[model samples]
Target: MNTNDLKIFEAVVESGSFTKAADIMFTVQSNVTARIKSLEEEFNAKLFSRTSRKVELTEEGKILMNYAKQIQHLVEEAKNEIISNETVNGHLTIGCMETTMTLKAPEILLAFGEKYPAVELEFKSDNRDSLISAVLNYKLDAAFVSGPLNISGLEKIKIKEEQLVILASSKEAGLNKLLAKEPMKSIVFDNGCIFRERLESWFSHKGIHNYKSIELNSIEGIINFVDAGLGISLLPEEVVSRYYQGRNICTYSLNKQLGTMTTLLVYRKGKAPSTALQSFIDMHIEDIA
Candidate 1:
């Protein structure tokens, strides 16, 4: 009947079980069950069908879920609008790709934090796909991505263009030439990484599809793995240049045919940017341009 009920419903759907949702929401399982029951009663329809295995959404629940999403979005917008007028003070959640978190983002964030110390900044670093989803779900105010992005319902502002390079340990000489000898082994972030996806697509396009992947979750892990001669990876030139100096990594530019992926500052369309967030983005735009 209220925002809390909508949040409970959304959490339950995402977590896939009432008990799990309760744990996430920091409430008892019965409380989660009661909230869902209250919501279903309010709609005069069943929202979920529970089985021994898992909970599934009923057809009516599907419809309500969509409405609930809109309701939650509007409520948050209202709250932000009210709080934004008081001062440029509130929580700002940003989604970042691992590469950006290393160097470029820090300078901009440092300046922003100093300028608006009242604004609390929270960052979530993950793969590109999840960042896009976070923006779509209103979980992040904005995100920085390496692209050409395929995200819908968002505005993509070109921040800068970064060259993508194939990198290996400095000790491995002539490995770039050896890429043709066999499908290269790669140390990759997960499937959601834009660079990882781009590299795979490039390989598939060139009829080189037999590479092996070592999956890791962080940029530090990738750099360390590549430093140990585990495999090669593709990253923005700026990111690697700042972080990999004297770290036993050698880099070579990808072919000109692959071009460069422009780095973008992305946010959902039709939403107003807060003063602090706008100022931060404007600073980046000014500094870059």
Candidate 2:
């Protein structure tokens, strides 16, 4: 119906609870319920199937959600386009892989902040897959992820190439000795991580399929586990060198095929970037190129 109705609907869908949506909208539960009821009545369709715990979107609601998101994005884009260049102030949410956040984000973000102090920036760290999903869903304006992306509705700019390396404890003399270790445990981020996928591929290439993995969410945790001789891991060389750099850790380079990965700044295709996002892209493109 109205933009306010769509906003409330989006909030309820995102939070999955009427009370939670009300809290997000800074309104009461009754107001949220009334808005949803009005929308359902107006459309003559059941929007959400409700349970005591939460609500699930119905078929009609799913279709409406797609349109609602596009409308919201277009509204925001129009506002950004009409605003004067001298006042480029808005929220910019970016998603990033953990390793990229560690090695590349700080300096760039610092400089961007200095230049555009009024623009709010929020950086969320996650695995490549999750970050991509967030960007597709319009939860992130853009993301820093590994390159060679072939997904539809996404555009990417190459930021830099990073050499991937195998990390082990110093107690291991060489790659051969490390591979010969019993159980062949690996320290890695969870399933959706690009590095973890590469680690698995490397193991498969070497005809080793029985290795065990210790999944962690933190880059520091994986590095510490590798340093403790608990397991080996595959990560960008810069990440290991910059973050750990401990005497207990040893780095082994992958063969050229597995060694190289490009970090890319990815955003939705066909959408004009917000002024703040455009500024970030312009600032980095030359430096990275």
Candidate 3:
């Protein structure tokens, strides 16, 4: 029930280790354990299932974790909002898609941090769906995500519009000829990926059905697999060109209807951003998380 207990709980959940969470808080492991025990006693529910390797959340723990995260974020938001605008402070947690994190977020973080030196910033990166879910649940103050976002109760500010491109190996035939040769196999992220739906739509449009798809978690893996002639994938032109530079990969532009995606800075619709978060949006640099 206490904010401090929830904060400690959040740290433990994030670290997955009482000792490490204690280290982060500059406290002893026993103190961390005591705080967790206090929380469990106060709520009359077990929060974590402990094992030798790591602590896992129980069903009740998972439910409480959501509320704990939302409370922790709100506490931070309130602290930041109550501070003088002339001097911004408090922690800001933002979510971002992997593409934006890699290609755009660095400069934005640097500039924002320089402007509000007292503010602490933490970023979590994942697929668009995950980012959206985190933001919706108040796990993040805001996030940089790609569309199409159909979720409710979100306000989006379009930051970047990227054209999706298909990368083809230089040794292989062009897109048409390549598709003709085999049932398409793509190296992509799992179902919640930003580009998965678009990529599937593109295939369906081309009358290519029942193709083989493989999931990969790394940007390098996706690009390398395609470059090695494993399969084709749809990705942001700007990102692929930047990361896969000096390679023998050639980009094939898709139809405008299928190839364009927009990166958005989305937050809850009714809530106002903290000064620290506002600075990030106002900086409005061309790219990054």
Candidate 4:
């Protein structure tokens, strides 16, 4: 029931190792282990399945991690609000994809900061899957991501639409024809990316199987490899425009028949949004409308 114990548990989960968490907190590894043990004893539930190499969260541990994050977020928000006047100040954590960070967020972030200078913006950028998990875990106040996000216990609003495109080195001609004929070499984000999922589904439906795929973690890395003629990739049109415009890349629409994917603004349901969070969402609603 002690908040400090929850924090210690959270640190262990986030750091993925007691030794690493101890190092982060400038404490001894044994101390961190003792805190986790105390918490497990209090809850009468195991938190982690520990091995020599790695620590994996049990189902109970995963549930506790989610609640711990919520408690941490609430504590931070309370302090920030109490310290502020009639202004939006304090930390505002947001999660976003690298592609969305490049294409969609800069102008919005700039405008929001200008209007609410007291607010401290904290950003976490990664693939879409991690972004969703962060928001769900209360590590983020909100996130801008591509959707039909169907996660339980979350609220979402469709903010915009973006097209997914297949790109190759512009010098490498006839990519569109090649895709129709065979699956060309592809560079993609890991399997969790929506574009990657959609692309895979599209190929499967087309009965195309003549492709090799490489998984890259970053959008920039994927584009770099594609531009070097290492492979082709499917990316959001806006991301392609921002990163690969005027580069040796050509884009083909991934079948307008598939329709436009929605970009969503998401937050945890039932949790009241802070003034700053509401303000940010309102601005997007106005802009998108």
Candidate 5:
């Protein structure tokens, strides 16, 4: 019914709980529930299917969510435009893959921090699919993701290309020797990771369909596991070189077909980026170019 009501709705949709949305909105659960109920009544539809554990958006809720995001975006754009002549101070939430967080984010963070100290910067490390979803939902101002992207409603800029490699313990001399280990394990990120998907494809290409997967969430954890000979992993060469340079690890290049992936900086296509976000994008472009 109003922007405040829509804000509560978005929060509930994102957090998937009226209680959690209350926590985010700095209100109580009853208020969140009342606002959602009011919105549903106004629209003459049930917006969410509630359960004891969580809430799931209904079909009508999905439609409203799309328009709610647009409204929120427009509201922010208006605020940004009104303050265009003022100091460059705003919040930016950026998302990226864990590998990029390790290899690329530090320099960008350092430079951006020094230049725009007034802006608040928050970074989230997630897999490609999660990052894409966050960007699409207005949760992230921008994201750095692995690409050859073709998603609608998003704009992308190729920032860098990383060569993918098979990382193994230094005890293994080569890829074949590493593959010979019985019950070969793969140390990888959780599902929805682009690198993990590529690793699976590589295994399938080699007629390997039954290897065990050791899912770890952090880049350091994956590298440490690989170094300990617990398993092998597919990761960026730059990431391995940077984090495990002198450790007991070796990397073998993948064939060209599966070897390279581009890192793209992506944002919503039609939305005008906030001052802080636009400044960060400019700095990223200059840094990478």
Candidate 6:
């Protein structure tokens, strides 16, 4: 019905829950529901299929999402062009892998905020695939993802490379005991994580299949699980050093190709960069190298 309605609709579909949409949009859940209802009434069509646990867009909603995104983009571009941002003033949503958030991102995040205090920066912590998907959907201005990323529809600038390391508990038995342990559990992030893929490949290449995986949603939990002798995990050496320095952990180096991975700052290739995003990339992308 209106721009605000479209914005709310887009947020709901993207967030997939009224509660999350309300938080992202900075409003109440009832208000989000009301606005969406108003939109559906105005358009005389149901936009979302709502259930107890999930909110998904109906077919009509999908078509409207494309238009809503375009409208939002144009509105954002217009605002950026019309405003004089001699000191950049806009919102930038950046998605990142949780691992990068813990180790590599703090200094850059702090510096960026201090330098451009007026720009509103929101950071989302997610796994690699979700981060890339968010960027493609225009939910984020950019994302920090680990690579040898060869994904289409993205432009990636390598910022840093770190060696992936195998971690085991210092007090726990080494390989022999590890291999013989009843359920050789792998501590890992949820399925879409690249590091998990690497760990799986490493096991298969070594003819060690049938290992059970303990899927965790956060890096700290995974590290703690591994450190407590529950299972082993794969993580970047930089991350392990930064967080577990001087802790009771043993690190094993991997083969070159399997060990090294690049951290890339990526954005949608054909999408026009807004002033906020462009300034961000120019400041960090070039500054890093």
Identify the candidate with maximal TM-score.
2
Off by over 4 Å in 2: 77-85
Worst 10 residues of 3 by lDDT: 280-289
Score every model by TM-score. 0.85, 0.92, 0.76, 0.83, 0.88, 0.81
Q: RMSD (Cα, Å) of candidate 4?
A: 3.2
Off by over 4 Å in 5: 11-34, 37-56
**Steric overlap count per candidate:** 0, 0, 3, 0, 0, 0
TM accuracy, model 5: 0.88
- Per-residue alpha-carbon lDDT of candidate 4 for residues 95-168, written as tens digits (9 for 90 to 100): 88777777766776788889888887777777688888888777788888887779887789888788888778
RMSD of 3: 4.4
Report the Cα lDDT for residue 204, model 1: 81
**lDDT tens per residue, model 5, 1-289:** 7899999999998899888899999999999989999998999999999888999999999999999988887788677657756778777889999888888778877878899877778889998888999999888989999888999989888898889998889976777976776677899999999888999999999888779999998988998899888999999898867667898998888998899998899999875677778898888788778
Please, what's the RMSD in Å of model 2?
1.9
- The lDDT values for all models are 0.81, 0.88, 0.82, 0.80, 0.87, 0.84
The whole-model C-alpha lDDT of candidate 2 against the native structure comes to: 0.88
Model 3 / residue 123 / CA error / Å: 2.5
Query: lDDT tens string, model 1, 1-289?
Result: 8799889998899888999999989999999999999998999999999998789899999888877876786676567668778667766788888887876667767888898887878887888788888887777888987777765688877888778887788878676454674657888888878888877877787678788999998888988999998788888777677766879998887776564878788987766666666766787788778
Off by over 4 Å in 3: 4-69, 81-85, 285-289
Task: Return the lDDT, model 4, position 85.
Answer: 60
Q: What TM-score does candidate 3 get on C-alpha atoms?
A: 0.76
lDDT accuracy of residue 188 in candidate 2: 92
CA shift of 213, model 1, Å: 1.9
For residue 49, give model 2's deviation from the true position in Å: 2.3
